[model samples]
Target: MKTSLAVASATVALAVLFPFAAAEAQQAKPQSWPGIKRTDLQRHDLSAPGREVIQVHVDFAPGAAVPAHSHPGEEIVYAIEGAMEYQVEGQSPVTLKSGDVLFIPAGAIHSVKNAGSGNAAELATYIVEKGKPLLVGK
Candidate 1:
């Protein structure tokens, strides 16, 4: 298990447990969702425009990374090749290999490092709240 947070609403039963729990669950699901290639993601159903959602295919050359950044929305990264070390603000990093997943909550400061010896890649599906931008450069 990993540290997480969730948005909650009174109408949502799970929200009753803890407001943050609901947000965590909602944001966390994307990290574990099935993934496809960048081309495939282009053909998949995407959230409405202006709603702030994006599917990104991140390819790395041995040790490349997307760089450190923060976002207004929750993000999920699914490893498509090799392995990756993921770290969030104030937490120990975790490593994941092909088919592995990582969940990052909204506004969580995080970074990704490619740990594989060869070429590596990851598919990131970013889910953000309405009207929020998907990715912010560090």
Candidate 2:
């Protein structure tokens, strides 16, 4: 009877703690958006103090959009396929085609949309502060 009670107590404890654990796990990773796929290509520590570089390949389904967000540092985006429109805060939206590049200043609020009828993709390179969330939604 004592062994069963102990097991029941442990189970209750786990049940109580599980949600907090899950929430922490979600915060540890970057936020995700529907219809957007992000693949981490590489990550390396930069020479600058407390800085790191992260390269990601992002694919957007037709007419998909990412909500306004900002990074801790600068982002260099290279459009790889199809067309994408980028809207940077306080600036006119710009569309980029294949092989085009755009530089986004650090902490600049921005959003992206797949402007073409087909899927669009871009390679994003970020120079950001280490140990901080790569993307912060505005």
Candidate 3:
């Protein structure tokens, strides 16, 4: 009888603890923004200490936008196709077409949108500090 009672007590404890554990696991996952698809193309450590470079291919559906965000370091963007409008803090918004490029200074809050009728894409190369998140939403 005592063995059965201990098993029941343990089961009840687990039942009470499981939800909290599940919630913590969910919160530990990284946050993903909607309307944008990002594909990591490459990552390499830079010669400079604690610095790294990351290349990503980003695609935006028509009328889609990435909300204001900032990076740990510089961002060099090359528009691959369609039109994209970029708004950088302290600067006027600019629209870039295919083959156009833009530079964003580190920690400069900015956002981008697909301004064309169709999908737009860009190759984003980031020079950032190692072990830090690529983007921080504003």
Q: lDDT values of the candidates?
A: 0.64, 0.87, 0.85
Candidate 2, residue 126: Cα displacement in angstroms equals 0.3
RMSD (Å) per prediction: 14.5, 9.4, 11.7
What's the lDDT of the predicted structure labeled candidate 3? 0.85
lDDT of 3 by residue, 22-118 (tens): 4532442222445677766777899999999989898988988888888899999999999999999999999999999999999999989999999
User: How much does candidate 1 score in TM-score?
Assistant: 0.60
lDDT of 1 by residue, 7-73 (tens): 3332364445455433543443433323312221422334566445567687666766655668867
Question: Against the true structure, what is each candidate's TM-score?
Answer: 0.60, 0.78, 0.77
Q: Which ten residues in a row have the lowest lDDT in candidate 2?
A: 21-30
- Tell me how candidate 1 scores on lDDT: 0.64
- Which candidate do you rate higher for lDDT, 1 or 3? 3
Tell me the tens digit of each residue's lDDT in model 2 across 61-107.
99788889899999999999999999999999999999999999999
Model 2: which residue pairs collide?
A: none
Query: Which regions of candidate 2 are displaced past 4 Å?
Result: 1-25, 28-32
Q: Best by TM-score, which number?
A: 2
By TM-score rank, best first, the candidates go 2, 3, 1
lDDT of 2 at 80: 99
In model 3, residue pairs whose N, Cα or C atoms come closer than 3 Å (at least 3 residues apart or on different chains), thus clashing, are none
C-alpha displacement of 16 in model 1, angstroms? 44
Which one wins on lDDT?
A: 2
